[model samples]
Target: MRLAPVRDDVAGFDAGEAAAFDPQPVRDAGGSGERITSLTSWWHTRWCQVCGHTFRRGDRVLVADSRVRHLDPTLDCAESGGGRADEAEVVRFTEGLLATWPVVGDVPLTRTDDVPGLLAPPLGGLRRAACLFCAHTFRPGEFVVMCPCTPAARVCARAVHRDPARGLPCWESWRPGSTLKVCPVTLTRLAT
Candidate 1:
């Protein structure tokens, strides 16, 4: 989708120092094996692939070079008149797939960087919640991850600290063992 970082001071991708980032292990994860550069947004908005929400200004996002193509009646259905059927099949499959993923009730912070804006304080319409991993209330601008577990396995769709750099490695601590990588709450297998 060609999204740039949402910083007012930065003019474009070249203006900011780009770094390599591993793609989040999500469904249909897109990104070439090559090192990808993150761009700063001067002007433009994009929908978060993980949450499907609009990206606010000043939000730092990691974007991959990928495009989702929709089948067109003339280009695809013309060959077999299967556009409608194909579209319906795609929709049904998507719905079924999404049903299997984590069911966080609120709009989730897709990346650690988005926590500042999405989880801002009351003066900024704060979202009051606690981290499932450590049981501590989340402070504004803290890096966190909304528990990406199935509804039955989640403890109120909690948010947990994800940034290890600042000494809060709650997310990394949640799933301690390498045994199938299940959620700690109910041992339910995580989608990603």
Candidate 2:
């Protein structure tokens, strides 16, 4: 019979450290507040499984969990004053990110009316923008860029250009204030 690892009051030996001691795979949430179903040494590194983008330990990376509300479509385009061409340019910028990142899990290439309701408000808006290429989503006030080549235009700009090996895709920009949230992979912008 195996005994569980005893948890102590040590600083680094918090819940996360204790969970790692268990021989059986532990299901828990990460420090970033993301729900982690399993432990992976891969996460120990700054590399993002969803997009294969690397980061330093303290660097802030966006985690898109569709378990929350889907992004609003009304906010997809530029904020009225911004011209259509300007919106198009933003979209182009997002496409570049998708081309570069690894995109961890299966993402919908197109937008669907079947989008689920808000499990909870994302970091920025009434709903979070789901990634067109992977499981990632933007929190409220969180910004991302996507590629036009993707089925929709919901990619994030910040992480998109970080990795050069992935290269740039024809993309567009999606800001948090828009009424519609466009899917970078499918280019489908859904209304809130």
Candidate 3:
């Protein structure tokens, strides 16, 4: 990946910024004295800090994010017609996704509160979830991950009745006043 030049204003004068601003210099792992080629390739070959899994390039992967937790690195799925993913791979994949995406279980806030905290301006991307039971897909517009109910109560409800095959209530089923949860297109549970 191409890295942009670090702007003076963006770098700031903070001590913390100085320590972690640049990517660590990668040594020749095999002692051949050649510089590493790519971030994705280097990450796969080197020891991953987030998850302990070591990997190589050309591995098929999946990404997941839980906003409450750190993002995972790219994962090497065991079923991806490749070898089983190591523990480090799994952890890194989780952390990377969380860091990159507008994840579910993320803390909700008003624009005034959240905007300043963001690293960049709001991004438009699809956020998806799969039903554990029937494998049906749900996107952000179709469902609200951060429910208004208590966390414990909401977790239980989500676990017990989130199967699309079971025909659980739509977003409107619970909150009639919510304009945010409906499908942006058909205003139904499954927005085409």
For model 2, residues 1-192, the per-residue Cα lDDT tens digits are 433433344544676677787656544343333232223423433333333332222222333442211112222311222112355565566566546653433322322222322112344323243444333432222232334233254343212211222221212223222233664444677554
Query: Model 1, residue 21: what's the lDDT?
Result: 46
* After superposition, candidate 1 runs with Cα above 4 Å error: 1-127, 150-156, 177-192
Q: lDDT tens digits, residues 111-163, model 3?
A: 11222211122235422223223233332212232333332233222211121
> Any runs in candidate 2 off by more than 4 Å, and if so which?
1-24, 27-126, 140-143, 150-192
lDDT of each: 0.42, 0.33, 0.32
Off by over 4 Å in 3: 1-82, 104-152, 159-192
lDDT, residue 88, candidate 2? 57
lDDT of 1 at 109: 33
Worst 10 residues of 2 by lDDT: 161-170
Error of 3 at 170 (Å): 14
Q: TM-score of every model?
A: 0.28, 0.20, 0.21
Q: Of the candidates shown, which would achieve the greatest TM-score relative to the real structure?
A: 1
**Of the candidates numbered 2 and 3, which has the greater lDDT value?**
2
lDDT of 3 at 116: 29
